[model samples]
Target: MDGTLLTPPKRSARARGAVLGALMLGAFTFNTAENLPIGLLDVVAGRLGVSVPATGLLVTGYGLTVAVASLPLTHAVRSVPRRHVLTGVFAALAVSSLAAALLSSYGPLLAARLVTALAQALFWAVMGPVAVGLFPPGVRGRVIGALSVAGSLALVAGVPGGTWLGRHGGWPLPVTVAAVLGLVSLVTVAVLLPTTRPEAEPAALGISPDRRRFALVLTAGALSATGAFAGFTYLVPFLGDVGGFRPETIGVLLVAFGLACLAGVSLAGALLDRSPHGVLTGAVAVQATGLLGLYAWGARPAAAVLFLVLTGGALGPVFMATQHAMLHCAPGRTDLAFAANSGAYNVGIAAGAALGGLILPYAGVRAAFLAGGLLAVAACAVLLPGRPRPAES
Candidate 1:
């Protein structure tokens, strides 16, 4: 038997559910920590005696750390049991969150966030393979989608809730809550999850062995994400400038978008395993259509929100499907492949924002949406031509 296949312990339904719950909780905790600064930016800046623009670096710095460190850190812990590595990462995140809350000073807080960023980068890199190992292959798409739901929930509830709490209770309150949740997740994982080892199997039954094909998947993902972010990053301004939405209305719209994202992932969970390529193709088309709609009809308030919903719904599933595709295509090196995916995602985000900024100066915000639409169309072109053959074991 190859080292790639490990038989997971046959556990009861309740036990399996507990394990999945713990993993999801861990996902929620880390995602909340990553986005907490977005909520506390003004408060943190005021308390730390810095400009709000300077505090924005907190988000950028964390993204850079995750993008740079994901592959190397995952490689470093390649030989460790996934259970142990995850537990350690959660513990570190908890500690870092607590430190950031207590220190409150800008420099110390930034340092603490960077610490958590390292853990987050590594966590995302390995979580896909870990989820696959714990569940049956037939339900892989569902498991991955469920896990991705945690992230969507974080965006929908965590950030807004944290901001509200910070506004009422104080900035430190949110970080402290995140730290406590991280600890709870750490305890849950340590107690509930079984120790699992990596399989030495060549690859999964339907995966492709061609490295170039794997690279294509990554490229497509990057393009799709770039297209999404180009308009998404400037959505608030677009709504205000074009649609004439008030501040409160825009906040409601953001929540609506998040809910659409949740719905999107739920649907993808059911369909992805049966037809990975088809799902990707459909998602890309939907995203392109939504963006183009926004470009053409954004001046109308109702149409703008409608297209926003469409875009969010399609955009939400792309992450999970892409991750599933990567893990499926390279089951033998799931961690490494996912690390690359994580990096690609971050790069796409940065690139899309940069491109949008350039377009914003020369063209109006609507033109940026058109640019994003073109990129999404290009992404679809890349994936529609070839079917990735299932690799031989």
Candidate 2:
């Protein structure tokens, strides 16, 4: 595991820190690009002279692209060095962001977004395994959690900041900033990250390699994600329409929701190694409770906010636990397994939003919460049959 021409050499503490920072920043930047359109929807639509709904497809299209491409691209890169491959991913993100910034037409902008999505496909599939490879196996949970935190910040900080830029400067300004962030991450990673060997260490492979357990992880994670985003996608409108909160208060509430997510991921990080199954079980249940609660009591602003935070809190940990389980129970190549998990997750995101959209007109936005809650509860049932065995080393 020590120095080789291809594999990671002995890493200094500082080098490892730099490497992780690069990866985390890469994650943050990619996610910001992915979600930035949500904040810039109206602005982008107006500038592009398109319908708001058409402009919103940037997010949906991006998720679908990642979902469809992750496995194939991960397979395609199987023979390549991960560090070098990841550099390409970052480079693509930069190029795609710049294209988004420059494109005058909606069709071209969508194309640019999808290009970034393709890079993200490869990025998510590789990042977890690569980060796990760098550290001692004992702290893998924390590592994954930290990485998820970087992503969650895309919701709290990155999107809002981009929104500010888009509002003040133009839609392209935030997209351009994302391009710069991607370039910075690309350079930092290229310079600092130690090269990893092509062959995985036994420690790096799944401990159990159970197809059934791995399926459960993906199924449960996807279900909960579907449910969470169902309400989450429409949450702002729900708050305004149902909860009667002012615009300024809703912004504050969003920050609280984001903080709650961080709290959940941090707690899961501490507990995941000890109880991966338990952590997942608890998170899905909390997810169900939050969504169901929202459906039942969302008319009351206090209860609505409380359940919203609860939903936010459980959301990050659910995916964290899913990735952790995938690492432990993958039936084949760990990277491929991670790729599948990432694909499944994006499928959930796209499905949840679409489902919410379908249900919103017919059943009303509150019904989305019910559908999501039921899905999370079903996820809980999925976990009951059997779970991944913890490593006994």
Candidate 3:
């Protein structure tokens, strides 16, 4: 047996699961905090005495910070204890949430969002590799699948939950609750995560990558993200203004989409171990089809809901595929790979939201979906010809 396998097997499994669960909860809270403003946009806009476009600055600012911070933070903390770093990141997020909750003015709120974005960047930068490290190679996919499932549940639960809470108690209440959850996650990480370093030492896993391949993967990830979020960011308005669904009903539909994504992520992980590129290519195509279908048929409530669920399901494999590609591009540098991917994802969020905002003023929600479809198709074009084969660890 390997020396690293000396710990009690049952205790070890439970500890690893708990750590993953905690990380998932952190991911949930981070996303919830980031997106809560989306569902409550009108309310937030009115309260801050600003236009919807101004309020959107909150999202854009947060995304930009995350995009800029991921790589540097990953490099700076490469040798730190995983648990310690996780705890610190969550604690910072909790502080930012508290600031957002307490402040009533726009400037303070924007500043608070920037702080949360930094924490979120660090949190995601650590999660992928940490999830991989917690399990032996034989079960790596399953462990990551479980982590993805937890994140999916959060995506499904967080937005609607925060929206409902904000509706009932005001914007600050949901943010406060998110802060509390961050604290809880912090405690969970400190207690459950084992003390471990990266299997490949920091020096050995050189943080640099071939510039050409790096740029390609990064561009592909950003384009794919742009496609995914174009429709997603405007989902609530589309359901309400176009599809004639009530807010509560829209929430339910969003939850359903999230659950579908959870299922997709689980299935994708299993399939990815065998043929990652094929899975990713299929996912992108399916998502593009779903986005276009929504644009064409979204006026009907039932059709809109069904197509949204399909879109979410198709989205499930995209992340895994992107991560696989990044790691392959830089086989030894897991931290840098994840950081680059995380940055691309943030850029995607910013691009998609900005595009949606620009189009929603004149072209309507359908136009946003069309834009997303075009981006997805572009991503497919970039990714298909140069798909890298899986590298042996």
Candidate 4:
């Protein structure tokens, strides 16, 4: 036999690209499904004969489940094959979405939402590590950036898509569409993803942290996420109530914000490959500026929209940088680090939304923006130069 024949056949680049694409698409689909509830709160409340705040609990419940489930699930599945785990999670998501689509009562719907959240936490907790394993170190940031774009697209498309479906065919239509997308994702992962297990160092795969560095990064990530969510959860109301934008106009503005985020992630990926530290610092500062600008210009529709878009742009880069930092800080413990970051992000979302809710009833929607700005500034302070100790081992 020839020497070439003795060597294993090289995997085709196209095949690898397909796998990456599928993974990203799956991530996008899951996030879209998770967020669909946000746009449909009013419709769901009306249909279930519940108050709007009660309907909002669906979001809270899902987020809380994700926050609690990600780390433990990551630890439990550390030794499993990545593709198998992804396929299982996708299958779970599809099942949950179908259940939600079929259920008429609030209790069953809530259960379905919780299941979806569980699957989502599992998927996201694994995605970063899988992406890193798929590519060479040189291109890892770019690969991550590409995935971020797909996720941002989901955010941009999912809400409007869900809203349109709800309007044309009612709430169940959007949930059904989400389920169908999850099924498609399941099929793609099963067929396309590689079955081989990568040999990762034990340290890189665990939830136990390097202590000093992990704490600093986690704290920064949580605060930054809090700031972003504070403004984001209340975006529609802020645009409509304070900026005097119509509901249609707010929707259009949100699309603009999503586009800006797509651009930010793309730009930041290139920067991350060179200097993640600079990108992190600049992104945090810009995000703080954008939030404060929104608050300052709350009365001006044009200016507030401009600021909001800038804020979205800043958000993607900052998040990507923080995530990259966490992975680097822990070296061999990427899954755990990422899961911890995801938890922090979810915690921030919950905290920000709760804070926004508290202020909304008392200080009005604009106060939410101010709160977000303050949180961003605080995150920046925590992550500033010469503050946190370097990673160990």
CA lDDT of each candidate? 0.82, 0.86, 0.77, 0.77
Model 3, 1-393: lDDT tens digits are 122222222347777677777887887788778778977888898889999989988977888999999999888988887777898999998999999999888999999999899888888777766665666545555655666676676677788888989999999999999999999898888888766665432222322334565566678778888988888888889888888989889868877888889888888878765676677787888788888878888898778887888899987668766765554455446666778788888789878988998999899988999999889889888867765533412
Q: What are the per-residue Cα lDDT tens digits for candidate 2 across 152-217?
A: 889889998999999999998999999999998899889887565545432346766788888888
TM-score of 3: 0.84
Off by over 4 Å in 3: 1-11, 42-53, 196-216, 236-252, 297-303, 359-364, 390-393
Clashes counted in candidate 2 amount to: 0
Q: Residue 200's C-alpha lDDT in candidate 2? A: 49
Considering only N, C-alpha and C atoms within 3 Å, which residue pairs clash in candidate 3?
A: none
The TM-score measured for candidate 4 stands at 0.89
Worst ten in a row by lDDT for model 2 = 1-10
Worst 10 residues of 4 by lDDT: 1-10
Best by lDDT: 2
TM-score of each: 0.94, 0.94, 0.84, 0.89
